[model samples]
Target chain A: MSAQTLYDKLWASHVVREEADGTCLLYIDRHLVHEVTSPQAFEGLKLANRPLWRKDSVVSTADHNTPTDHWDQGIQDPISRLQVETLDANIAEFGARAYFPFKDPGQGIVHVMGPEQGATLPGMTVVCGDSHTSTHGAFGALAHGIGTSEVEHVMATQCLVAKKSKNMRVAVTGKLGDGVTAKDVALAVIGVIGTAGGTGYAIEFAGEAIAGLSVEGRMTLCNMAIEAGARSGLVAVDDKTIAYVQDRPLSPKGEAWDKAVAYWRTLVSDEGAHFDHEVVLDGAAIVPQLTWGTSPEMVVGIDGKVPDPAKEADPVKRAGMLRALEYMGLTAGTPMQEIGVDVVFIGSCTNSRIEDLREAAAVARGRKKAATVKRVLVVPGSGLVKRQAEAEGLDKVFTEAGFEWREPGCSMCLAMNADRLASGERCASTSNRNFEGRQGQGGRTHLVSPAMAAAAAVTGRFADVRTLA
Target chain B: MKAFTTLDALVCPLDRANVDTDAIIPKQFLKSIKRSGFGPNLFDEWRYLDHGEPGMDNAARPQNPDFVLNFPRYRGAEILLARENFGCGSSREHAPWALDDYGFRAVIAPSFADIFFSNSYKNGLLPIVLPAEVVDRLFAECEAKEGYRLTVDLPAQQVVTPDGTAFGFEITEHRKRCLLGGLDEIGLTLLHAADIRAFEEKRRADQPWLFA
Candidate 1:
């Protein structure tokens, strides 16, 4: 047998059939669902009179439409309320392996909850209707996002009709500088590759820097793969992967655990494997990164200045930068640190794990939010994450620093709920995207890491976390 | 699913690269359970001056005069001409649902993000990928001429311009067949139910932990 990449091995093992045109009916082992993308899919199943193939393969939760604040008050917006109710009705009608309702202890963003519950395992193919489904690929699973129609297809057939993506390796070597976290590495990668760089390929993060990252850090890296235009991002499984999956609620028990571990050990790429594309980055040179424009590719170090469109050679790109600067209320040559922010968001599927919260809390331990900063929101990824943070006194650390400790949901990430930015309000966010009107209509979002967001919260501007005492 | 054959219609040129899904259909409107009614809210932020919510009367909203979608000449245009990496962010099928509802039969672009491209096919919206230079030429031609239209022949795999210039595009045989037939992918895949079951059975025997 020829040496195979990790993607190749996963694709081959899951092939139920291959059509003449080279499309494969790939078997799906896990399907994670959230409120925003599932309603239409459930309706599709009902319209077609199709039954779910394997209820045991599905794990669902309501996150997007659930308000991160005021759980006791219930969802204030009627439309948001209906969406969450619709998911609950669908899950009740079609049973799943697990269904975490809005206030369920296990409830969280589907991407965060899936791996946290051990439902997302190594050497398996995972999917969700949300684009951030790539987050589960950090577990060495072949995970990617699907459309609502494909969600129905997966529901009815427990399989996906997929075309295999080409293999691309992004190897980051050398040591990361102080305060240069996984979010910085992800931003730096996007900066090098541009937004559409990995369009048709599955990127595998490798080399010494990738190996040194913790499991949560690996997840943060893979979470932004979608921002780089890749459907999936992966990392080969190792001891850290094994340890993370060992005692989770849904993990295999007793004899099955040993067998699963043995099989997962083989999930790595074979030596001498071929790759269609490869990129190398020096991690030591990467500083804390932030987005200066609407696109993730429009990123620079925290010390860098806003890019001048006059220096741009491409007219389209220059126009885009100009539009972004206007939308973000930024000037061409202004230093990034000089920019002030009205709000700071520290939550999303990208960062909101216990580690992310701890990182933010470390910076915000005793510091007070600047008077000019209107609000600082610290939303946990899951109810479990919230509970864990509270246990570690991380919630107190945030609240003591004048931050609002909120419940678990994708708060202010897409801002489908009431937690959103006002018109023209500038926010330092730990979320994934910086697109125009993403946080809210006319709201400006600057993408940064959890610590960066905390630092911005304390100083009311983009502050360098490394320079702190 | 409506079968897509050929579309000869006026072109609306959207001269922007990386037009993300959020720009196509904003998140606020995604609360709907049904796929219809999204067309009115398509490019809501860019198309209108005020912020758009789900139940707001789009008819009363002040339209952005500069937006191409609002231009009198581009009204009722069924073909959208766009630049590179159109539909670049988020996996919301609402983007295509909105495009289809807005009466766009086909979108010709330099490139498309993978997920949006796949979702477009499922909703009967044909996404045609042309070279960047060819797309540039189309944009220039569409802007220069009023009521400029193009004919997309899916069966022939060519996009024909008003001046009789035809540019070829690629589509897989399986996708082409499905699109032409207005076929349901779930039904098509279920034809091989036995194959799927066999594969599952083999996996269960080999890696029993997955089933557990």
Candidate 2:
């Protein structure tokens, strides 16, 4: 009986070479790219006049800078248009396929579209130049973000040099209470561990709470794994994972499916797996979380109070609290429940899945958005998610509640697309990262779960959605 | 560019928490990638006013008295004082490029988001991590004196004031070696050139079918 943590097992099997200072070169199975970071690397390739090392193993997409509205073949923003066009030309020239333009059924946020379209599989290592590449860990793959140069390196050579990080397991037990979603679970883990707690670690999600989540929910949980400061977050593939990818367009078929399932089923860490460190949380105890400060770690349950600057006994932490208060126009000890929201956004790779939409729609079923709330945007993660939501009439529910059911893409996730918060508007967002001015200049963002976003939309303040039901 | 290193330089002007990449470089200016001209646009909105275009010497301007970075004491700065979640949002490496291009050698913060933090390190910029209490003291000291200079020694794992006040910080030895060597990922790759070439030859020999 082999007793090993998932991280140790994964790292040991994948180790190609060990470097000085304890870094190991691990092989990468898949490499994904996007418009924002690919230009330079392609330029590097062009400079070298080298054909890509392998085209089949690499994929590209245009998501970060693409708008979610009607696909304008001629986009208005020249920078965005050129980047997209340049990438298109490069991919065509390289014989690499790329998902481009509006609402590509294969086109959605790269992280979401990758797994939904079966581009991501379990027991594989995936890397994207974008940080949220950790999102694919839901399928039990060790996925992490890489630099643009590394992207080119991987394009030129499929293998990557990686340091073997410490393995940690975060076990969240107990069933989630009503109004809590996968976004809440991820936020709860991050709040307890703080952002950098997982530094130099690969965290595995396990225990009853994680096992209970569906595949889409699992994706949401793993999407912001980087938020916890882990190199990647992974969950062992299970029936739920297999079911999700089984019938997808690009998934392995017939005999290939059998081989994939056989391999995936073997990916689970053995029982009694030992981890270097362990953290535990009870899902039932978690409330709707909202980030009151700039960092994702500076979060408290919706029913909690803003931390007192003085209470942060360490001077550096206290200074951080004070500065956060200044940027947020919030005071220490202010009740999070009393905070009012100027805008409500319920999309992003974090919470743009169909399950997130269903949860928001369930909350907004018979309700009208509060009069004070100015904007409510519901951007789905992928065209598939959008199509499924429309089939279920979830879009109608959102529209009736005064929310705009937008097309698929990474809309307003980082304000890379046209979607953004006007300056000074405090927004309740279902996205990760509430850094000061993340949405726009001087714009404040309070990160929360989708239901909380819907609740904020209905009442125009950071109200507790758990209490609404 | 006389071998200017982030070590012994760079401190935050305002002790701010969550000084995002946008604050490092606002979104509107992410329109190009020439890599030669982002310095003028760094902190464009905060340092300039209605009448000021990007090219003017921002330090000479009346300056937005209300802007967090424009406090009187920390003018002509090299160091930045920041709090947790510094450099959150979009993975555009350009954010750090703008800061590095615009004369920022180092950022002293209690914490940083993972992507931005790693990006900063790779771009020949130093990101110093000090305890929250130590960071607060630096902020207060920078605030107290006009043009107070702070020095950071990467090899010593300490930050010092002009008056020789020293504070210890944390960094992994691997990162220290990388920064001290001025090695980017390319440099990392070049280190293993022999091993890579040998591996390529071996792989080709083992799988003759894979080659042209």
Candidate 3:
């Protein structure tokens, strides 16, 4: 019905065949599983008395359930432990490679680890059990989250019943300011586009600012692309992307390297390629932003006031905003900067990369932790990042500034481990999602950039770090 | 698995709207790619909480006698009466598996979460959406009575009740065929084996340098 927008071309090329029922059976190039969703799939296989179809195609990691504090024990929480252990057994049984127990260099959030290890190559279709799996699209891949049933389906048969999605290219130009991080840019785009604007489409993130971001930051931006209801998000691989992958363990060497780069260079949208929809945002126009409501879309710049639900164009949205405000203990006209936070979390697949840490450390220098702030934790995304940062004294800087330099793990992203906001407490975070009770029951979350998070740790409120710097 | 359809008898309790998938299987249970374990954790908070069954408390306790699935009235329910926008979060296949594993054949709601709605048909879990008033009527009628039964015919796109009442359901023509034909991932692939083999062979020859 439309000219190929990279998505159609990819889908049409990858379609192994069409089922008699008219559903097309597409082959999956990669299947990444995490501790949270792999247990059931492995158990299902056991129940069916079958082994993994292609054990090598499957990749497993223990992130959601493992704790940064303990390496000897798998996880402290029973629920987290159960899921992680389930994944471990499943992978062991099927002979799939798994990164587990601790956030060693090989283990981190599935999306982060995949790219860092060069497993997320260009032109591949990646699906994981986590919604943020869209993060892989930063490498020019078609990636999205799949369900447990779909996971089992892929395991039993490396195929998926996929519907063709429309292509959308969102462009944001200009240079980002001193303090605004990739998270802010992403939040601003979603805020303007609304949460469901990209529904039924795969987003291609292009333009100068997007192209300027480091590979990890690009991944962080694409990670939340699904938040806007897009199938996935991508940037055409460039020098930055190629440089990031050159030294990775799985990256090709010598002869293979030349071939890989040549193919990777071809992963861009051809000229005159049309997108179903488009949105353009000027990067320099945005300030540091955060979410004050339950959804990521109800975001306001740090200097702005909480939106009045009464002004919302839709009734359902209005009611939702009101509910979010009530839960967040805020009212209309409340300045977002004045909001005090009890804790500050600087981790998640979204912002735990080395660049994110360095950005926060730059703000944390010469700044002491707030006496009123209960906890300021900085968890690196992977052991490699942790080791690299520590070697560079980044960890020392964070710790000296009263931040807890925790081990590499998905700490404080969810209550999967020991790090979680106590009920009724408010936190400044770098992770995506601010849904009610998302962190913990009755806990409030304000999604911000890493610099803003560090600033929150210093000032105990959402402050504009650029001014402080 | 056998396929059958009817929707007239499907009924749920008081209107619980916007049933997101996080509340269905939850982000907590999504750590693995497996589907079976989620059945136990389906609505883990709701199923064990007082809100779900009216008299349950202390979800952490070993015994909660008043949970919804533990209730007598809703026992052996083939059709599920759900609130609006059920299954609204991440396109995980586990949501449908959890629902299907728990023995729900069809989920009737005013609206369905987009991803979950698509996944339901693939997993053989029929998701039916009717007008809010119509759904409310069915829920009320069932609550007023008991053992409400609704039947759905995928080919006909209709749901039939015990008293000969009939209601039409909507589905994409393609998905409707998928459900009726009882096709799954492997089944779909097998149906196109010849074409797939040819495509693979041709690609292998055309891109000989690319194969590993």
Candidate 4:
């Protein structure tokens, strides 16, 4: 056997058949579905008169369109209500291994809920209709997003038609600075490697800085892989990964657990493995990061200034920067810290776990949200995460500091629900994307870490968390 | 999925890089369960001056005059010419769905995001990747002249400009065949039911805990 990358090993083990053209029918171990992308897929299945190949292979929830603030009011928007109801009806007719419908104690963002429930495990292939399915790759799983057509294909047959992705290694060595977290590391990686740098490749985040992160932190890094144009990202399994998967409801018990652990231990890449592309970054040099522009790649350290398009040599890139500046209402050479924010959103699949909430709450413990800031929303990733935050008094800390402690849903992340930004309203968000009109039709979103979002909430500007006394 | 063989259509040059899916079709319109009807809302925010919602009368909305799609010269354009890393955001297939519904049979770009590239093929929207220099030339030609159209011959794997300059593009034979024949991927994969079952059985024995 030749030395192989972890991605190669995972790819080989899952291959059911390989066509002459190099397309492989890869087996999917778990499928996570949500409201937004699954409806059309379900409709496709029904139109084709196809039955779900293996119902037990699926776990579903309604997160993207569910209201975060007013569950008691019961989804005021009629269209949003119908979408959630459609998911419930589809799951009832199609069946699933597990389902956490809206208001279910276990319900949360699919990416956050899957790993927390142990449904996303090591050395298996996980997929979802949502792009952030890469978040599950933190467990050393081969996970990626599939379009609705592929989603229907997976439902009809428990296999995905896939081609092997090139292997890319992003090695971040040295120690991270104080107040710099996984979100910063993820943003820094994107800043260094343009969004298309990892296209057609699966990136493995390794080295000392990666090894030092908690599993939740690893997920945050992997969640942003799609933003960098890669469909999937991975971290090799270790003691931390095993501990994270240890005793969840879906995890193997007793003898099975020991066997699973042994298998997972071999999930790392073999020495002398060849990679198609490689990038290296120093963790110590990475500061708290924020996207001053619309694209994730358009990020800079909090201490940096908004980029001037005139300095950009490439006309296409310069035009893009100019458009972003106009849309974000930013000026060239303006210090990032001086930019004010109207809203602070500290939730998304990217950073809404208990660890993220704890980080944000630590920054908001005694401080008040700035009077200039209109609203500060702190949404937990899952109902379980919300309960855990409440248990630790994190919710109280946020509420006392003038933040709205909301329910577990995507909320303003995509703003499919009522929680959204008004036109021209600038927001400091912990969500994955800062694309134009992402939060709302004309909203301006600046991507940052949970702690960074909290810092922005307190000061009503892009404040450096490290400078917070 | 519609079979895409050849297209010689007017080009609508959207000279932008990293156009994300959120901008392609806003999240607000994603509430619809059906795939159709997304065309009217395609590039919703960029095309219209006001906010767009599902079921809104698109004809009544004031069109952004500066938007290239609204230009009278590019009216009924069926091909979109774009910059690098087109369709570079969330994995909402709605981007391609919207483009296809809006009468775009093909899109030519310097590069494309992996997921969007694959999704485009599944929806019968040919995403042609050309060299950056070639794409730049095409954008220049498209912008310099009105009613400029390109002929995309997928079977020949070439995109021909009106001036007889043809640029070849690369695509996997498997994807090309699927698109040419309008094949159903799931139906085709199900042809190997026995192989899938055997592999599953072996996987269950090798990693029993996964089943447990």
Angstrom error of the Cα, residue A118, model 2: value is 0.7
lDDT of 1 by residue, B1-212 (tens): 88999989999999989999999999999999888999999999999999888888999999999999999999999999998889998999999999999999999999999999999999999999999999989999999999899999999999999999999999999899999999988889999999999999999999887887
User: What lDDT tens digits, residue by residue, belong to model 1 across residues A286-372?
Assistant: 999999889999999999999999999999899999999999889999999999999999999999999999999999999999999
lDDT of each: 0.94, 0.75, 0.75, 0.93
Instruction: Summing lDDT over every window of 10 consecutive residues in candidate 2 chain B, give the lowest-scoring window.
Output: B203-212
Expressed as tens digits, the lDDT of each residue in A1-469 for candidate 2 is 5787666666665555676776565666667878777787788778777667667656667777777776755466777778778778878877553354444576778888788767787777788888788889898888988766567777765666566778888899999888888888898898898877887678899989899999888888888778887768989889998888887756777866786688778788888877888999998887778888878888888889988887777765688778888889898778888888888988888998888888888788889898989889999887888899999999999999999988777777677667888777899999987865567667789988888899999988888887888
Cα-based lDDT at residue A418, candidate 2: 74
Per-residue C-alpha lDDT of model 4 across residues A326-348, encoded as one tens digit per residue: 99999999999999999999999
Per-residue lDDT of B131 in model 2: 80
Task: For candidate 4, write residues B50-157 as lDDT tens digits.
Answer: 988888899999999999889899989999999889998888999999999999999999999998999999999999999999999998899999889999999999
What are the RMSDs of all candidates, in order?
0.7, 4.1, 4.2, 0.9
- Candidate 4 clashing pairs, residues 3+ apart or interchain: none
* Candidate whose DockQ is highest: 1
Compute the lDDT of residue B127 as modeled in candidate 4.
97
Error of 3 at A183 (Å): 1.0
Give candidate 1's root-mean-square deviation (CA, Å). 0.7
Please identify which of the two predictions, 2 or 4, would achieve the higher lDDT against the true structure. Answer: 4
Q: Sort the predicted structures by lDDT, highest score first.
A: 1, 4, 2, 3
List DockQ for all candidates. Answer: 0.88, 0.26, 0.32, 0.85
- Model 1 gets an lDDT of 0.94
lDDT of 2 at A362: 79
Candidate 1 chain A weakest ten by summed lDDT: A65-74
TM-score of chain A of each: 0.99, 0.96, 0.96, 0.99
